[model samples]
Target: MSQIERGWDAIAQLDFDAALAIASRLLNNPHLDIRHQAYRMMGMANYRKRSVQQAIPYFEHAVQLVDNYKDRFSLCMCYALLGDMDRADRLFQNIDSLWGLPVECYVSIVMCYTEPKHFQRAVDLLEKIKLSYTLLGITDQTFLAIRGQLAFHYALDAVHYVLNMVSASFDTAKWIKSFAEEMDEEGKKSLALVSDQVCHTKGPFTINQPNSRLQYPLLCKIEDVSLFEEERILGIRVLYGKLHVG
Candidate 1:
């Protein structure tokens, strides 16, 4: 493991600020690999702290050093953190319209577009993207790395719920009823677990530290989305979940 990765053990142990400090210095370490690894570690760290500003530079520098879709897509993440949907959208648009725009980045874009509430325009855009209404932004990759499409779908539904909450602030029952109506009989049965499914992530990575817990956003997985829910819900919570996992 590199220095940054080694320090990550300490950071994951709960030394947040200390981890940030080490990441800051090691990000520029003489070793190129260490530098990039440091940046990635810092990006994940900032993400955990919800400090989008701190993650930006690390992700930006990471973009400069790496050429693969993961790293480039990584930069779009900073845009999402900064709530700059325009830039994040544009970057994904420019990147060959590839299928793997990094699920992480896509989740962020959804968060920005669906924030506060869901507008018809947002719904239209989502439907367009989902049904291939235009297919203008499609791209092909060697293989599908669609790590958590379900997570994204569930997120959208949750956003619609939030929209209802915003539109009808005092009627929780009414809101749940309307939300439930949108669901099919089967999906309604799992509304309680919708969040549990969407919130939990399944992966093969492991690390030991005091703060490491299932609640870690890094552990949050994007499960299969329901036919009834919107992706916006997944976007908002997934972004938050990624932070905890980190």
Candidate 2:
């Protein structure tokens, strides 16, 4: 097997020292792909341990080889692990520069802070998004996400936060969905503008990412499963307007 494949094999086995040794050796490989892959192996292995600091350098190296959204998210997660939320915030703030990293970056920032019950800050960020969308105005805007026309992530995260603690009531989900729909054309244009700048591949940005979907118990999913009528009612009865306090 190629050294790169061997290195990855070791990493997949959770053999950090062996993986590191293999990675250090592959670092000197002539092929850029091999070099990049080595860094990913190193970074990913560390990430599996919930220790992002060690992942940072390897991901940074990957960026030096190919500056893209994927590498940036890897590095961004490292910063998040280090509790440098400003850096994390900044990365999302400038999504134009980090588009290909998939939707996780956007999702992760809000999740990292709010999932553990950081609602007020999440709300503040959403409000900021709303204000920005308003400032852009319809004519001046391009996409809703970027133009400050609407805060999709803001709304999405808020709904998610409220959802986890509350019962699987359509009322709560409906409220969150309505808030997203409230963004005016200008806001939508701004978001589109951001999307255009980030996604140049010409097509709707919708694809089933590989093992990348965040799992949530939305009412839609519950309904799809043919949840019994009583069970569904009970689910709705559970969480009226709750919060996670840790």
lDDT of 1 by residue, 1-246 (tens): 755655576455545576677777886678888787777667656655666666767777776876556555555655654556577667766663665553433434553442423334344334334424224454321001121222223343333323321222243344335444545554455444443432232322222334222121112333222211111112333322233221
- Write candidate 2's Cα lDDT for 78-194 as tens digits: 565455667766775565353633322343444344232344654455444454444656321222222121223233222223333233322433343343354445434433333
Q: Model 1 — which ten-residue stretch has the worst lDDT?
A: 140-149
TM-score of each: 0.47, 0.47
Clash count of each predicted structure: 23, 22
- Can you tell me which runs of candidate 2 are displaced by over 4 Å? 95-101, 114-246
> Candidate 1, residue 176: CA error in Å?
2.7
The candidate maximizing lDDT is 2
What does candidate 1 score on TM? 0.47
Question: Global lDDT for candidate 2?
Answer: 0.46
Per-candidate alpha-carbon RMSD to the true structure: 15.1, 17.1
> What lDDT does each candidate get?
0.46, 0.46
